[model samples]
Every structure is written in C-alpha cells, then in structure tokens.
Target: MGLFRSIVGGISNLFNRNNDGLTITKLVDLLNQGYSLLQINSNIYDIPEIRTAINFVAEKIGSVPFYHVRADNEGNMDMINDSFQYVLTVRTNKYQGPQVFWTHVATMYLLNNNAFIMPDWDNRGNLTALYLLPFTQFQFAQEEETGKLIIQFQGNSSYTFYYDDIIHLQRFPTFKGGASKQATGNYITMVNAMENQAVKDSETSGRIAGLLQTKVNLKSSDMKKKLNEFKDTFLTAENVAGLGMIGSEYELLPFNFKDTPLNTEFLNSIIKQLYNYFGVSYEIINNIASELQYEQFVDNTLKPIIYQIEEELTYKLFSKGEISFYNKIQAETVDLEISTLAAKTAFYKEMSYGTIMTRNEIRRRLGMPKGPPELDKFLGNKNFQSLEPGIYEVGGQENNPEDGK
Candidate 1:
C-alpha cells in the first residue's frame, strides 16, 4: 500500500508542477528503459508535473518505461521501485508498440488527472492522494506525433498526468462535452442485446432486428445513407440524456417500431396472407416461427405478390370505399397470392403449412376490401386439395363434376 501510494503521489506531483531540471529529465529517461523509442512533445517533458507523472508511472508499472529522445544531450535516468520490481526510462519522440504496455497503463491511470489537479485546487486537497479518483471525462488533443500514438486532450486546459503521452488512451472530450469512459452498465447492455439477436437468428428466421440490428449485402448508396443516419440517431440518443432514472419526469416516448407504422403494418399484412394460405392466425404463425425468419419469408415470397396486387388492385375493386380499402391494403400489406397452381405448387413445400391464413381475413379485419374471388378460390382449393385431405377433386371436378368438358 505504501509503495502504491508513493507511485501515485510521485506521478501526481510530477504533472502538477512546471519546471525544468534533473527530476523531469530523470523521469523521462526512466520511462524509456522498458518502452521502445517514440516521439513525444519536447515541450511537454520539460514540465515538472509531467516528469513527476512519469516517475509515478514508472513506480506503479513495476517495469522499465522508456522514451526516445532525438538529442543525445537529453539526459536519461534509471529508477527502480523495489516493491513493484520495475525500472523506468523516459525520453522523447522515440518509442512505439506492445513493449509500451507500461506507457499505456500509465496513461490509463492518469486519465483522471483533471479532477485531482485542477488549477484552483488546494494543495491540501483531500482526494489528491487516493488511488481510485472520482469519475471525470478524459480529454485528448493532439500533443505530438510519435508514429501511431497521438497524444490528444479534451480541451485546451493544461493538466498534469503521470504518463500523458500514452497510446490510444489519450483524453479527448466527447461531442456532448466532457471526457469519460464507457460505463460498465452500457457495455453489459450492448453485449446482452447482441447475444439476444444471435439467439433469435439461430432459432427462427436467421435475421437481425431490434437495437444494434445489421443488414447484409446492402451496398447501395441509399442503404449506406440510411445506415449512417440510423447509426447517428442511435448513438446521439443513447443514454446521453440521462433518462430512465426513478422519479424522473417520465414522458410517453414512442418506440422505434411505433414511430414507423409501415414495418408493422407490412409485417401484419404478410403474416395474415401467409396465415390464410396456411389456415392459421397471425399470432399462431409468429409464435411458431422466429423473428428473424419471418421477414425473410415475407421478403422473398410475399413482397413481389404484394407489388403485383398493388398494380392491379386499383382497377379490380369496384366500390369507391372498397377501392380505397384495397389501395390501403396494397400500400400497407405484403401480398403472397399465387396467380397459378404451378407457382403455388413450386413453393408449396417451402410455404409454412401450419397456421397459414389469407389476405381477405386480414384485410377484412383491417377494414380493407373483401379481396378478389381468386383469393377465395385459392383458399378453397388449398383446403380441399391439401395432402392431409387425401387429394379430393379441387372443385367437384375430380370424377364427373368436369361436366363433359
């Protein structure tokens, strides 16, 4: 514990002060011993606070931390923290790679420097000496370029850090303001959502939906635009508003599906048509099939039929109200009606037989047209001629109902 505190204390002191001398140079040299050479802001290393931060990092990492200096005149110092059993070498503009693990660790720890070493902070600040500091956003601004490691900060505000120049972990302010790491809750939520999507795809239709949904092979520019817009909407709205807390002023917010009635209506329509064809209800069919499969089944088979019905429904339905009603069905529902027995036969096996329903039932429920006589004829034929029914005459035409044709 003593050693740990000392390590923290040294780094805090180093970044909190601004001076040029052996202490700062020594800190730089010590960090370099373990890390490979990389470029750093020469001006930054000259600060006393930064030097101290380096020393603290070296002490805590229990490994040599090295820096690369362009000039030979830049003095190198080696320091060993016996309890932690590590050495440190600090330099400038020279190191890069996995060997820089100590550098990254130091940076990660120093991410909280702003909360502790504020400009008007008291020298006797109670929190300054603690190991785990309070949550504060990390800020990253480009300080110097040492290969891929870019030292960035959130704001123009100058704060001392033990290892301010570490890779990837540099502090940068978020667009909404302030610097902060992703919360544990956020991570767990995202992971769980992803797992749920996977499980749903495996058991059902094998497609992605809901939060974090992804579409495959959608390379069109329009699709890309839609995807980017969706991403922006999701990221911008996510938890940043601090909603969902107990006692907060709750608003009747609409869900994603609610805002867009097209998807739901379309789904409802397709499922109904399929249900009619299969002699089942929407709820029964959905209950049996997985969410992922439902969409695919509709897209591949129903969408084209819907398009065809939409093209012809205008002229076919005669009553003014029924015309309007049929139009609504075409606009809102998926059409899976087959024009010929051959087409129906081709898809008979693929079509989900259990719980199939018809478009007319769905349309009537939604106040649409009674649908074409063809729809009824198909339903009648399917019901009577199904393999389960032992292959009866389709329309009293099996034996003598053919009427001497």
Candidate 2:
C-alpha cells in the first residue's frame, strides 16, 4: 500500500508542475504532436507489400513456442517445458491468447519500431495476465531530473513503471529518443511509388473503352432536339455494342487508345522488390520453396527476430540469479524432415554409432513417443568392439595374431 501511494504521489507531482519544468500537460501536448506525425505519414500497414512482409515475420515468430527453462551453476540449461504452458496456450489476456497477442505485438513492432506489453500482476506481484498496447496510442517520455520513463496512454491516462514491469521490444537501436521516438518503418520509402502505380493502373483500365466523337451537319429547325436524341441513343451500352446510323450525314469517329496497358512485369518487379527487402523469397510467397530453401529462410531471416524476443523476454522476466537458476524463454526450431524410412535409418545409424544420441533422444527428434527407460541409455553396435591396444574385433571374433593362424 505504501509503495502504491508513493507511485501515485509521484504521478501527481508530474502532472501539476507547469512553470518550473516539464509538466504532464506539456508532455501530453508533445505526445499529441508525435501522434499527428504518424497520422500525416502514410500507414505502411495499408500497403499490400508492407502487410505481407509484416505478416510473414510475425506469423513465423508467433508460431514457435516460447518456453521457460532451468539452468545450473555449471551453465547447463534444460527447459521447464510445461511451466509456461498455461500462460502460453490458454490465454495471455482476457480478450486474447498468446498467439494473437504476440502476433499483434510483432506486427506493431515492425510497423513502428517498438512494441509494449503491460503485465497484469496479482496481489503477490506475479503475472496473471498480459495486455498489448497499440503502438500509436502510447507516448514514451523520460522525467527531466530523475531520468525515469513515463508512459502516457491515450486520453488522460498515465502510468510510470520500472523497466521490468513493462516489456519494451525495440526493433532498431537508438542512442536517444526515449519511448516516444520512432525509427522509420522499413516500407515507408516505397509508399508513394506503390500508390502512384495503383493510380496509373486504374486510369489505364478506364481508358480501355476508347473515346468516340460524332459530327453532324444540321440545317433543320429541330436540329438541337435531334442532336440530343442522337447522343442519348448512340451513347447507350446497347448502341455501343452494335453501333448503326440511319442517316449518312452522321459521321462517328472512334479514337483508338495509343498507350499500352500497364506492364505486368513492371508491377511484378515492384512486388518482388518489396519481398526481397523483407527477405521473403518468391518461392516462399508462391509456395514452391524446397525444404532446404525453407530452412534457410527460417535461419537467415526469422531466427534473428526469435533470438531478439528471447533475449528481451529472458532479461525482463527474471532477475540475474533467478535467470541463472530457473527462468528462460526459448523459440523452438522448425521440425526436421525425414521423408523416407531409408533417410530415417541413415540418420539414426549415424547418430547411434558413437553413442552420440540415446534412443529416446533420437525418438524425440523424430517426433515419436519415448522408448522404455533402458532405451534412454546410449547404445552402440554389439558386433563391432574395440579390443586391447587399438586392436579390433568384428562379429564377436578377435583379430589376434596367434588366433589368426
């Protein structure tokens, strides 16, 4: 209760001081300005390429499970695999589950260069639920004298927290710019080009029905009325399909379009550029990537993002000693492919020769159920054995010089 009161008092002091230094009102005004900057800039999310890039990264990361781990003094680590299962699998927040929450966070981080998560703590201060704030809705500022970060949410809401209480995932490195500062979105530079192309495409399609001009020399008193009737009938859809004129004096001229249709190759090139910029190959988008390419994509592009999230989560979620003892988050690698029984046999044979991996370990890697407890022990081929002083034995027979004769 005392700690809570102190937090409230500090916030009150932040809001009231208007003349001496930074005030809450001034901060709010600054935040509003920052928000306006985002509004004026074209939203990268609106562009198809940007959306595809963001989705590709976010979905890949979110699909991997995040685990808590235990570690020993000797630096050995093992997953407390099921410890975070409830939080990760059931619900991370009241309204959203872990997948949705993480995907949204990842998407927002890619768009604005930052993402935030506020954990809902129980009475014991353990995390009970989590909420992801919209990146644009919050402004980050630091108190001038104290150097404490202040997070101001939309409207009159404001909250100050220790760095650990809030998960702040930043995509780009920055020396300054507290929380409010944003690194430019990766796709922002191409927005105008994409928009221009879209407009050109639309205009080109509209001109496919070429312009028509009609000329008539009229001498009668009812010429104006006749001209109006002629235009109405001639311009109709039915008449355009099968245009005909009863009078020879009426001359209809069709102006053929000279400009070629928008080059699909050029448009496709732009899309390809966007994909390449985000490290997504055409084979991936078209679903033609081979197994090797897929693995490369995950390792080269996706793994770094997963590592970033892992480091941040590990640091923020646990104390130094606690982390060394029993807390970690890991992103699981994609499942390995064993296409045929021959491939599986070859892989197992290689792994088993030197007792490199136990039977259960191989089974686990192959996604099969665990074997009996004895299978947990390392086993090698009984037929091949090492004899005294580098001598060899094959098929239970000793290759001794005396016995060979």
Candidate 3:
C-alpha cells in the first residue's frame, strides 16, 4: 500500500505515553504525556537552554534555500528549474512551504538523530511530493520469508512499511538497527537539581527575608501571628526596602540574596555542554555572532546537516545511472539568505555594479520576494561604459563616443 494511505489508516494510533528510561523526580505537563520533568531536564526540548539552541539550528537550517543542479563539462554546477527543485525550494506539499517543512524535519532529525522521509513516487517511480514520517519510536528488521527489510513504527498505533524508497537519515548507526541512541546524558541529575533549586529559590525569594529570634515565650498561635506581622512588614512590596525596627531582645539575621542569583552560573556551565553537543554557541543562539563566528557556525554545525540531506536526496531521488550522469541536489547556502542585514548590504554593494548576479538572485539574498521576470537578467554597470562609436540621442543632435563629452 502507498505510504499516505497507510498513514491515514494509522491516524487513530497516536502513541501511548512511555516513561521507561527516566526515574521521575517531577512530572511536566509542558511536554506531551510520555515526557516527564526529569526527561526534559536532561537536555530535551523542554529545557529552555537546549530548546533555544535546537530552534536556532532548526530555523536556520530550514530557512536555507536549496537548489537542484547538474554539472557541465567545465565542472561548474548550474541550477535547473525543474519540479524537484521547485518543490524543495518553494513548496514541499500543499500544506507546508520550504521553511515549515524543513524546520520540522530538522527538529525531528536533531531530536532523535534519526528521521525518515517518504518520497512520493509516480507510476514510473519518478519523484513527486515528500512527506515527513511521524513516529515516537521505530525499529528495523528483515522478513524471514521475503528477506525484504521492513521498518516498524510504534506510535499511538503500530504500522510497518516496506523499506522500498524510504529515505532513512541516521547518525551513528548501530547493530541494533538504529542510530546509536545518545542524548545529553552527562548532566541530567545536576541539571534537574539546579533547575529545581532555582524554582524553589524564585518561589521563596522574598518570603525568606530574615530569621527572627525572640526571648519572649509565646504560644504557637501568637508566634504565627507575629511571623505574619514580620513578613508583612518586610516582605510586602510596599515596605520591601524599608528597615525594620525590632526590639532589643530579638535577633535579625537577614537572608542576603540580592548579590547572588539562583543557579545562573552553574546552570549555564552545565547547559553550555549541551550547546556544544548540538554544535552551537551562545553567540549563534542569541544571534549576536560576528561574521567569523557565523561562518564557523555554518561550517561546523550546518554543513553536516546540509550535506546529509543533499546526499540522501540525490541518491534516493535518482538512480545510480542518473546520478552518474550528474542529476543531483545541490544545497547552496544563499549568501544573502541567512546573512545579517549588514552582510546583505555589503554583498549588494559588491555585486550590484558588475553582472555578477541577477537582480532576482540578489533580491532573494536580501530576503525579498521575487520581482517581475524582467529582473531575471543580469544587471549592467551603468557607472562607466565605453560608448559605442555611433550616434547618441542628445539635445536634438547625435553625439558619438569619439565626440568627447
């Protein structure tokens, strides 16, 4: 059966919540049923730091425009305006454009280090639409009788599909038939503790203003009243900065937390490792990166992902003979696409004069929508051009290039 029909059949089989791996310290409603607080604390998407890093990558990778191209005799690759490239660069399906589709795919890939893309095929096995497969868990096995490989997804409901034409992206594959399952496991406990501590600190920050010790032997009820009075005097927003005038017999031990923040440094230190694991720095995540830093991020982090997608798309979408003849995908990182405004302006200055790039091409880099087809041609430098030795229309007379200005 076709993958789409199978998915429609399996729509009722949403995944059941499973928390088999974690020893729960807290339960989180932020994530879906199976994901607990402990699970999220361990560098999953729920953690703010980790999510920021992952989203930075996902959005950037998704934002990158792709191209389908073929090589000529000069070894230079030229873009081909075919349906394949159009679908990848403009629209993936009826519902999603390039950004949303690729962002989701990247998120899934980064989250699991494994993802599957089912390429719709025509009657002749030519590529058509693409779909991102949905599954909470998956496994691969071979049929004993047919000896054909099969992939099973145990989500809300279980469904297995033949491995035919299924593009599997896996990192660190293992004998167990999937990517070697590794996550941010090095600092889960510490991160959980720190996160909890921070929450507790935030909750009781002002309430625990100081300790009050008195020599007066008061009843429990009276003591509660007195404590309330003290808290009201010092903890209340109106008198938070006011000095307390306590009796001589009482001791005032103020809880000094103004100078020290809760778990910020320690948490950042631990989460920095998470960022490093995902191949992003704070500069990249926060978008405060320099040109050098951005380039390094692209080279160190984004290149691997782009390469994997390109290779897989090329191989799966084309036959070996087709590939040998140079039909392939080329994921060109549009210079103006992900570049900063300053970089775009500088690039425009450099290329706007000479016929280096077409107007629409430059406009694309600047994040502008495509203009009319007339702008598709290269721009000529009008600043200085050799005047042809012919009549020029000027002041009711013809001026030639040889006629000096």
Candidate 2 off by > 4 Å:
1-42, 81-85, 136-158, 177-260, 290-292, 334-368, 379-405
Candidate that scores best on lDDT? 3
Model 1 per-residue lDDT tens digits across residues 154-178: 2324343433212122223345332
lDDT of each: 0.35, 0.61, 0.67
- Sorting all predicted structures by TM-score, with the top scorer first, yields 3, 2, 1
TM-score, predicted candidate 1 vs. hidden true structure = 0.17
| Predicted structure 2: clash tally | 0
* Residues 12-124, model 3: lDDT tens digits: 12212231211111112223355321231244676777778778888988877777888877898878776687788877865578888888788777777777776654543
At residue 267, what lDDT does model 2 achieve? Answer: 62
38 in model 3: Cα distance from truth in Å?
A: 17
Clashing pairs in 3: 13-156, 13-157, 14-156, 15-155, 15-156
Q: What is the C-alpha RMSD of each candidate to the true structure, in Å?
A: 35.1, 7.9, 9.2
Instruction: Tell me the tens digit of each residue's lDDT in model 2 across 1-405.
Output: 123423443333224223333333444465556543224124666777767877887786677767676767787768663425456666876666888777877777766666766545443334455566443455557768777665554434444444445667775555532244333343355455656766876767656343233355555656767766766876684567876454455655556563544555766766677776666777877778876777778777777777887887777655576665657777766332333466568768877876878989988977899989999988867656665686554343365545533
What's the TM-score of every candidate structure?
Answer: 0.17, 0.65, 0.68
